[model samples]
Structures are given as C-alpha cells and as structure tokens.
Target chain A: GEEVAQTPKHLVRGEGQKAKLYCAPIKGHSYVFWYQQVLKNEFKFLISFQNENVFDETGMPKERFSAKCLPNSPCSLEIQATKLEDSAVYFCASSQSTYGYTFGSGTRLTVV
Target chain B: LAKTTQPISMDSYEGQEVNITCSHNNIATNDYITWYQQFPSQGPRFIIQGYKTKVTNEVASLFIPADRKSSTLSLPRVSLSDTAVYYCLVGASTGGFKTIFGAGTRLFVKA
Candidate 1:
C-alpha cells in the first residue's frame, strides 16, 4: 500500500527533444511530489500537488518544465526541448497527512 | 523550509550502531525533522521522522533535543547492505509542506 509506481524506468532522448515521465501515487494518498537528482547529488524538489491542485511549484524551471496531476489519471512530468543538463533521475513520491513519503523507483532520463 | 547540515560521509563496520546527526538551527515551531535513505540508482526511502524528543520504529530511531536545533538518526546493528546515503529534511505542514533535501551523509559500511 505504501508504493508509488513510476513508469519508463529508463528514457533516452536527444537534445531538444521532448520527454515525458509518469507516476501513480499510492491509493488514498492526496499529496504527490516530484524530484530531480543529478550526478548522485542532492534531490531537487520540482513540484508538488495536493489532490490534483498545484501546491508548490517554486522549483520547476518555467522555461520548459511542466507537470500535471489530473483526476483518475497518473501524474506526469513533461520537459520540452530537453537539454543535456536535464539528464537525471526523476523520482515521484506520495504521502498522506502526517505520514512519511513513499517514493517510486524513479525514471532515469539520459539526454544525449 | 529549514536548511539542514550533515556530515559528508561516514564509515562503519558490521554489528556497530551508527549515528548520523543533522543540524537545523532555524527550525520553525511546526517543522518536523525527517530522514531518508537512498541507494544507488533508486529512489529515497523514508527512514524515520520526529518533531521533538525521540521516536523509534522497527528500522531506525530519531532523536531530537529540546532546542529543536538538531536531530540524530540512529541505526541499530549495521550491515553491509545498510550502506547508503542518508538525507535530512525539515519542513512544515502549515505552508505547502514542501520537503527540501540536503547533501546528505553517505555511510559506507564495511564488512
């Protein structure tokens, strides 16, 4: 029950191409979060949604990054005109009130 | 969001108890201290969390002082499989409840 599912375990896209990643939160969880990890460093929070509504998106790069968590569908993170710097692992997490987060296995995106 | 500082790395041997500490001096009243563990090429896993005093789970323990300035994650009887990067995060539910991750401490457990 504490499992967040992510699809496309690995993705390879050419520079300037578009990339999309999907995540399915645990059932009954209302909060979902997306994070980016690069070069085995710290995780950078990209965005979060509270019941399909944008809660905090301060970390999302406005230029080409966008996300949506729609009702009765999986959450998606899309990057347009992907850059080499954008190549990294994208992790999705879900949590309920006062409960700790459950993270997905992550999608490794390689932009060449 | 409260900033956290932790050791860059630590080394330990099997059967030893390892304690990794995190410092957050500017923690707010409602901020909660949380820890996560991450292995290579995988997503982070929640280890333990606490607001104040101490909290214990089957996997780990979280200890916070009265000042709420710092917290420590204690792992009992380490093994080689426990070697991973441990992250410390502090966030509040009042706001947007965004969790910010720090550099984290990489624990290398040697057999």
Candidate 2:
C-alpha cells in the first residue's frame, strides 16, 4: 500500500507571517488534492492537481492561499499573511483510481 | 456532483456490529459512493466504495441497493479504535477526480 507523505507534522506562525506546507503524493498517483479541516471538523476542498496542471481550485481562497504541484517536485501549499482563523489541519491526498484515495498524515497549522 | 446525507453521530459498544447509512438522492448514473474514516489530527482513510449491489473487502462492506440512491457501510465486530469520523462522498469518474466531503458522521465506540 502506498502512502502520501506530508512534512512538518506541526506548524506555528504569527499573524501576518507566511506559512508553507509540503506534500509528497504516492509514487504512481497522478492526482493530488489538498483539503483544509477547520475547527468545525469539516473537510474543505482547497485545490487539486492532475499531473502538473491545476484540475480544480474552486475551494481555494484566492486572496491569501496558493498551491502548486510541479514535475519532479513535491506539492506545496503556502499561506500569506496568516490569520488566527487559518489554524487547522491540512491534508494531502493522492489517487490513481477514481475511488481509491490515499491520504497523508497531515500538517497541523496553528496561527497565533 | 451528488450531495450525500448521513447521521451526525452514532454510538456503539465494542464487539458490536455497526452499520452507517448515507443517502444520495441526486446520485448521477456515473457516480460512485465512497466512504472514508478520519481520526483526530489525521487524514481521512479510505474504507470502501461501490457503484451498485454489494462490495466487500477486508476492512468493511458497502451495500448499494437497486435504486442507488443510498448506501450502507457495515463494520463487523467494531473495536474501540474504530471511533472516528466517517465521511461519505459521491462523484463520477469520467473526468479528473474531484470529491466533495460532507459533514462526516462521528462514531464513538464504547468499551
């Protein structure tokens, strides 16, 4: 079983600072997805990438959040001018099949 | 995209069989029902998926009736460690994968 790998299990940032997170999807999986889990315990879709192209980004907050997945590089999610409400867990998932999704351990971001 | 509805929370005793149902009234013809379990501070883990009829695997079993409007996930002899949030997702496979996770059903297993 392949696993998606996420770095920096925990992250802390001051308000107005920048925070970055990384994810390494499963080796052969072509689709990568990023989700944000806020305090309400809901998984909010942020963005998704198919290979090196952005497949969907409807859930992304364009003002302060951005993500990228490039060839031979791990996907990254960056937040500019972090706010207190930005504190939550970010999960990265990768899948080769439509129904089979493999998720990473996730990065817990805390903004103070 | 199909929307799914499920229970907000459920309680079960250890060693008991637990079944959680999800309703997807607007399920498209190409949509499939998938379930995922997530623990605190962790990512969601895939449990099972099905299009129609019954599909069983080592971890759980998914039962989809003829109408395909709803599905159930049956966990055999649950343990305390099974306490987690379960999410139901409905989506088609024609294009790139884009799943919508609704408010998950939280299951608390008692000892």
Per model, the share of native interface contacts recovered reads 0.48, 0.49
TM-score of 2: 0.95
Query: Which lDDT tens digits does candidate 1 get at residues A14-107?
Result: 9999999999999989889999998747689999999899999999998999999999999999999999999999999998867578899999
Cα shift from native, residue A4, model 1 (Å): 0.8
Tell me the DockQ of each model, to 2 decimals: 0.59, 0.61
In candidate 2, stretches whose alpha carbon ends up further than 4 angstroms from where it belongs are B93-95
For residues B6-100, could you state the per-residue lDDT of candidate 2 as single tens digits? 99999999999999999999999888889999988788898988899999999899999999999999999999999999999998643455788
Q: With candidate 1 superimposed using the best TM-score fit, by how many Å does residue B57's alpha carbon deviate from the native? A: 1.2
In model 1, how large is the Cα lDDT of residue A91? 96
lDDT by residue (B1-111, candidate 1, tens digit) is 789999999999999999999999999998898899999878899888899999999999999999999999999999999999999999964334678899999999998
Q: Which CAPRI level is candidate 1?
A: medium
- Candidate 2 RMSD to the real structure: 1.5
Cα distance off (Å), candidate 2, residue A45: 0.6
Q: Which candidate comes out best when scored by TM-score?
A: 1
What is candidate 2's CA lDDT for residue A106? 95
